[model samples]
Target chain A: DVKVTQSLRYLVKRTGEKVFLECVQDMDHENMFWYRQDPGLGLRLIYFSYDVKMKEKGDIPEGYSVSREKKERFSLILESASTNQTSMYLCASRSGGSYGYTFGSGTRLTVV
Target chain B: SQQGEEDPQALSIQEGENATMNCSYKTSINNLQWYRQNSGRGLVHLILIRSNEREKHSGRLRVTLDTSKKSSSLLITASRAADTASYFCATWANSGYALNFGKGTSLLVTP
Candidate 1:
């Protein structure tokens, strides 16, 4: 089975702090995505990368950015975390030919 | 933007009963997928149905898609206590590499 590992399970940060959430996939998948899941808003994509050194903004990308320096690793960065940014962060990866996504355990971040 | 909207925010059913969830989307899609997420966990892919296909089944789960109405339904027969989880419907558009997901329907199966 493909394994996606998130670096953190829970995090608490002060407002205006810079935070990083890391995700690494064991399988050599070409696509990686970062999404923030809120209570009633479902999952909103923050960023996605199809290849190393490539990235694209998703629906709600204003407060987030991503880095994909390697094919196996994708990172979501919050330049200046705010109280409203508190949410469950999920990372998902899909192979080039497959439509199904394998997700990491997820990180719940709270900005105070 | 959220392309899929699943109805009945919550559902409760007895064990051995069947559970059905409905989803509606706004635009043309390449495929529709159903996912299950246990509390405090990430989503696990359940099934996928292409736009050209009308229905598909895996195990005790049956999925039907109506492209004309841009709607889909997922039926899980013979529910068990372990089947309790939140189910979400996601859509893959013709042009994008990412999927749009719905809020999800929380299903509870009581033993």
Candidate 2:
């Protein structure tokens, strides 16, 4: 079975603090994505990387950035956490051009 | 911009009844997919229907797609309490490498 792992399941950070959310996939997938899920807004893509050192901005990438220094690992960085950034963050990966995604257990982040 | 919108924001039905959810999109898509997510967990893929196909079935699930209207529907027959989850419809557009998801329809199956 394919596995996607997130570094944390739940996290709490103070306002203006820098935060890092890590995701790792064991399937050697070429594509990795970061999305934020919120009530009534569904899942909004923050960023996605098709390969190491390459990243593309998604619809809601304003306050977020991504790093993919390795093929199996992807990280989401929040430069300065804020209250509005509190939400469920999900990581996903897929092989090649496949349309289906294997998701990691989400990390629920709360900025106090 | 989001490509799809699911109808009936929430649905409640008896355990043995059937549940149907509708999703409509704005542009041409390569495929439409349905996913189920429990309260706070990750989503699991349920079914995928391609644009060239009109209908498809898997076990007790049925999916239909209409390209002219750019809409799709997912139906679960003989629903069970264990099937209670939020259903999301996602569209893979021809222009992008990502799937655009809708606001999901929350389903509650009571026994």
* Predicted model with the maximum DockQ: 1
Number of clashing pairs per prediction, in order: 0, 0
Model 2, span B15-111: residue lDDT tens: 9999999999998888899999998999888899999999999999999999999899999999999999999999864436777789999999999
lDDT of 1 by residue, B1-111 (tens): 899999889999999999999999999888899999999999999999999999999999999999999999999999999999999999974447999999999999999
lDDT per residue as tens, model 2, A4-112: 9996999999999999999999999999999999998999999999899999998899889999999999999999999999999999998885789889989999999
- Superposed on the true chain A, the predicted chain A of model 2 yields a TM-score of 0.98
Question: For candidate 1, what is the DockQ?
Answer: 0.92
RMSD of each: 0.9, 1.0
DockQ of each: 0.92, 0.78
Weakest lDDT window of 10 consecutive positions for candidate 1 chain A: A1-10
lDDT of 1 at A93: 97
Compute the lDDT for candidate 2: 0.93
**C-alpha displacement of B38 in model 1, angstroms?**
0.5
